[model samples]
Target: MRVFTVAEAKAMIPEVRERADVIIRLRANLAELSLTLNTTGESPAGGGVAEMKALEAHLGEAIGWFNGHGIEVKGIAPLLIDFPAVLDGEDVRLCWLEGDERLAWYHRTELGFAGRRRLA
Candidate 1:
């Protein structure tokens, strides 16, 4: 539940990108696993239900970490993460933005879209 300033959150772009990469790979692997399950009606030797649970845990940890850093955990499919980080000084919204690229035009907690500013 740690709050962050715009600058602090933006500074995390690098780490975020890395985490994003991992998420993408994990998701792809999960899809493959799903297909295997569908075809075989069972997981491979090591790819048991436990592996799926582990992936879920990993995804949850990643999302939770991002949330803690002030970014809203939007849908994992489209990968939409919202920021600006506050809603009346109390983190209110999570995964509630309209578009992915809208981050540039969207507003922070205190400022509406009319007041949206570049992430400097």
Candidate 2:
């Protein structure tokens, strides 16, 4: 898995949201794929690494396509992407808490999710 610094993950939102609709669809599909393949209780059909690679490929494609359209992407950490982003200019980790409706958790790069504070 690839861990990304908070800075890296935030820079990609423009491109990511440019193709946000597509990304949402892909995420759903990927989740289904995971469920199906993970049913064996071992790992996905190709294993965890392969599954992560596939997601990376998909996200990379989306980012590339969007970037081609003039959307600049930065701060996109697949390994650590945990929730919807608010896109302020701070280097904060995006995460979803157990009960938040949308992504309402964030932490400084040095702190990480475990150190996330509420967004109120």
Candidate 3:
């Protein structure tokens, strides 16, 4: 696994945030399209198979970008990302959640998000 320094991780925040926003928008569109298709088999507000396919395609592209950048995309609902990093001589994951505006948290590898701690 690639380990990033804290500075390196923070420097990536802006780009990561932008990509995450794009994914969030795509996810919202997909959800809406799915709801409409499942219940009534068609969307009244411009959603359809083509639109869904486009959104999914963009989503896949975004995910691939993240993978290429070495950022771990953790969840979809509340989009989560973690950067493999070592801090204070210990292994940690720099965590970023959907609503976070900055890279200010981290967690030990074994603890998952339940162990998230603020960066100092």
Tens digit of per-residue lDDT, candidate 2, span 2-109: 344445544554434445656666666677667766675445455665775687689678656644643333334322234333336655546533223344457665
Clashing pairs in 2: 8-75, 8-76, 9-75, 9-76, 10-75, 11-73, 11-74, 11-75, 12-74
Candidate 3, which segments miss by more than 4 Å at Cα? 45-47
- Per-residue lDDT over 1-120 for candidate 1, one digit per residue giving the tens place of the 0 to 100 score: 556555565566667777877777777778887788778878775667778878878877877877776677657775656664554465423222322322333454554434544532
Relative to the true structure, how large is the alpha-carbon lDDT of every model?
0.61, 0.53, 0.90
Q: What order do candidates take by TM-score, descending? A: 3, 1, 2
Q: Which of 2 and 3 is ahead in TM-score? A: 3
Q: Estimate each model's TM-score.
A: 0.64, 0.33, 0.91
lDDT-based ranking:
3, 1, 2
Off by over 4 Å in 2: 1-20, 30-58, 63-104
- lDDT of model 3, residue 51: 76
